[model samples]
Target: MTTAATSTTAAAAVPFRFFDVHVVRTRLLGRSMVRITFGGAGLTDFASGGRDQRFKLFLPHPGQDAPVVPTEAGEDWFPQWRALDPATRGIMRSYTVRAQRRTDGGAEVDVDFALHGADATGHTSSGPAARWAARAGAGDRAVLLGPVEPDNAGVDFRPPAGTDWVLLTGDETALPAVAGILEALPDGTDARVWIEVPHPEDIQQLDTGAQAEITWLVRDGADGPRTGLIPDAVRAARLPDGTGYAWIAGEAGTVRALRRHLVGDRGFDRKAITFTGYWRKGATEEQLVEEALSGTGPADD
Candidate 1:
């Protein structure tokens, strides 16, 4: 009964539909990240809203060739999927769209996965999605709850009109979205970016027309404790003058602190900042899903 109510609420969300996709290829970005490309006839209608576009991805369990999603429920698929036995049901996760391109065969979408835990091989400490991403290959099947229209609600990196500058910060888990946002910034847009990664190799070359200065914070080579590096860096920097919009994501606690710092200490209006907690430290995605179900809630974008 509770699941039915939850599903009804979630199902009413607009402009998203399920599409079946299969992996076309994979690339190792670094020791801690991998990029997977998915394509099929179904992706012909997959329209990405670009910058920070997010979607739900479902993967199969061990020994299963395809994810066991109850798409037959149609628009109310969420409830049916929720009722499946955990061990037999599909593994659902959220991800950001890095890019969408056309090839001779069809349209393909690129998604970058941050490999956490022991190392980039993604063999240790990774949940289902990371492990699947690390080992995924051409022909691997999955399902995506993606947008059909270019202008959809799945994207969240909106800087309101007349913003003079922008500040963006995140850890590796939020890097893909940050890259997309930077790529979409207008020419000469003053932008400041901060990114934290476990290793230096995880740093990416971001190309953007915006007048962007990006600072990469590497945990492995830091002088002091790896903790609070981003907050410390932001505190010591001189921000550009004028109206600024901020987007901060990653560990929930850090995100809250940064948001508080921006609003309380930096004197920025709360309305000028967009904050999302991609993940909470020490909490599994499953736990997060449960929280959402129970209305404790954070449905990250």
Candidate 2:
């Protein structure tokens, strides 16, 4: 059931399309970030226009030959992944589609992974993602699942239909999604963005037609949850006088606080704010979602 403000969809029924692609290029953007570009025959079938969507990456098991991917459906890959025993199956993590390029003029998905530590597998401290990324070559095979398009199109939280301004807030974890949102905005749109990062170097410039005021909040010396900077930044922010929307993402507690400050304290229209807790500090994705939706709710910072 969908109200005027909210629409309920069968999340599980959403198609989980898979793609088998070959790594075409690799670039290290920073100490913790790596960009891998992939393309192949399977790439032709991938849908374009989903810059901000996310998908699951299935890494080949250690020392195993590249797995074959079925073009029609993804069920073939699941059994092989499950055969590794519950403990040995490679870790599957969610990553944003940074950019997409296609020869047919469709779209190719560009994914940037935070490779700060070990790969996904526990055999090494680093997870499998890092290990695979480190050794990835131009011809390596990768199977991608659920490049599900996000549902937030035309859903900006700005007050009044087609407002002139917006405020964006998030952490490093939300950078890819933030970039996509900014890219999708109309030219000459006016907006302000405040991003919290570990250091000043993490501030990457964005290309958006919107008149954007981006503030980078550094967390180098912060001891508590890295998201504490959002509250202070928002407090100091000077939003446009006209109707504006508020968007906040990243850590769970931080997002919750910003939500309250806007709708609860500042009295922004309830429909004028969108906040998503992408991930928690010390919890897995499943655990974070469970805690967030559970009646007990996630703990406060």
Candidate 2 lands at a TM-score of 0.75
Q: Rate residue 181 of model 1 by lDDT.
A: 95
Candidate with best lDDT? 1
Best by TM-score: 1
Lowest summed lDDT across 10 adjacent residues in model 1 is found at 1-10
* Candidate 2 C-alpha lDDT tens digits along 1-301: 0001111111233455777667888887644557788776666655534434556676666675564434453457655654545334544555667777666633456777655343434435444566677667788877777534444332323235756688888887677767877887788878889888766666787878877888888887678545568888787776777777777777766777788788776767766776666666665443543343343544432
- Candidate 2 positional error at 121, Å: 14
After superposition, candidate 2 runs with Cα above 4 Å error: 1-16, 66-84, 88-90, 104-107, 117-135, 147-162, 285-301
Query: Which regions of candidate 1 deviate over 4 angstroms?
Result: 1-13, 118-122, 221-226, 297-301
Model 1, span 1-301: residue lDDT tens? 0010010011223667788899999998877889999998878788888988888899998799999998778778988988889898888888999999887777899999976753435566666787788788899999998988877777777777788999999888889999999999999999999999888888889989999999999999655223698898998899999999998887777877888888888998777887877777667767776776667764322
